[model samples]
Target: MPERKILAIIQARMGSTRLPGKILADIGGKPMLCRVVERARRAACLDGVLVATTTRAEDDAVEWLCRERGYVCTRGHPTDVLDRYYQAARQAAADVVVRLTADCPMIDPAVIDQVVGAFLAADPPVDFAANRLPDDRTFPIGLDTEVCTFAALARAWSEAGEPYQREHVMPYLYEAPGRFRIFLVRSARDHSHLRWTVDTAEDLELARRIYAHFGGRDDFTWGEVLALVEREPSLAAINAHVQQRTLGDQA
Candidate 1:
């Protein structure tokens, strides 16, 4: 068999209801989306990185930024993100797909490679793999990484009819249990108590501080952030009040 092409697709749009245009929000004088793409590109296991944005006029900026930054971009459904991912993976000829969100500027490349490694190393070969799977999360929220075979993504695109499944992507595979062979890559320690995803003003503030601590660099690892927060315990409190919305909570 030919070598599997592992592609990382970062889904982004300017239509966030909680924090509109948050993907473009400044983190150390650079866009959060830029930080996310930069870090993802550093993953050793990924074949390439692509920004998957919608065709909405608001998202045009995202596409333009991708162009200016020399990043590959693909556009698809505005709300149906599963379709967006499926189309992006198809266009890239990806045998394996790594799903990421634009909100995660502090996503660690090491964690991403770990999850991808787990997926590739599974005995029977898992159809889906992720660092956090539903309620069993161990890594910080921003470090969320999901890897799935192109076949599984195509399956979700075709059969997942629920609105949440379409918008969030990958739920149909994990939520259904026996439908797909799944793997969850857990961190050595539980850091789910910390929040690093940018969803609200508080989240943005926390991320800004973290980036600033690194002197406006995007190469900092998640371990360094953990150490920073450990030395300055108040850093985690910046967005401690922000609650993550689950699929059931989403409209």
Candidate 2:
């Protein structure tokens, strides 16, 4: 087990610019939010998983989802995602925070464990760790893990300015590079070609296609997703519409 209590904070909201109520959207016979929780729960290194959603009454449905399933849920400022994460960490008394998004339902638990393991194994000790996406074996889309210390997150909350900073926390640490001990993990296979996020209609269609392939199995692995997509190349083309976030891109 890891020394620091690893808390997975999944930032979610009912309103999405591209796909409204995407979190509440259905995939595999369950809400997208629940699927995200199920994947996070599969991580062996995580001590717990909490869905950090906004306090808006529109999101009351999300809270009810948690209550209905007996999963942990938290409420905070919707746009100010940084504060939301901070409050969630406080609630869980977490020392290490793993930032996940509710949009990423097919996020691999094994990938999360590998990153957490790397954080614990660093000799000089790392303030944070992440996978450099679009480089190594194509990490499945929608699955991003940022493992950082509570101390670092506090500093980010205090020092980080600008709306983008508040909107998408912790870019300062990764972009600053040498300021913190940062390490990147490469995927063993070319799984990065897979897209598993729900950002747009295209993305959702792809997810629906994937669900159809897997018959909405909750325990579906990353490999299984890739294999299905391989058999049906058209499924991968669903999200060929939107461009992915670039290194210089702001939230």
Best by TM-score: 1
Model 1 lDDT tens row, 31-61 = 9999999999999999999999999999999
C-alpha local distance difference test of each model: 0.93, 0.81
Error of 1 at 250 (Å): 4.7
**In angstroms, how far off is 158's CA in candidate 1?**
1.1
**Candidate 1 versus the native: TM-score?**
0.98
Clashes of each: 0, 3
| Backbone clashes in model 2, listed as residue pairs | 138-191, 138-192, 139-192
lDDT of 1: 0.93
Q: What are the TM-scores, per candidate, against the unseen true structure?
A: 0.98, 0.92
Worst 10 residues of 2 by lDDT: 131-140
Per-candidate RMSD, Å: 1.1, 2.4
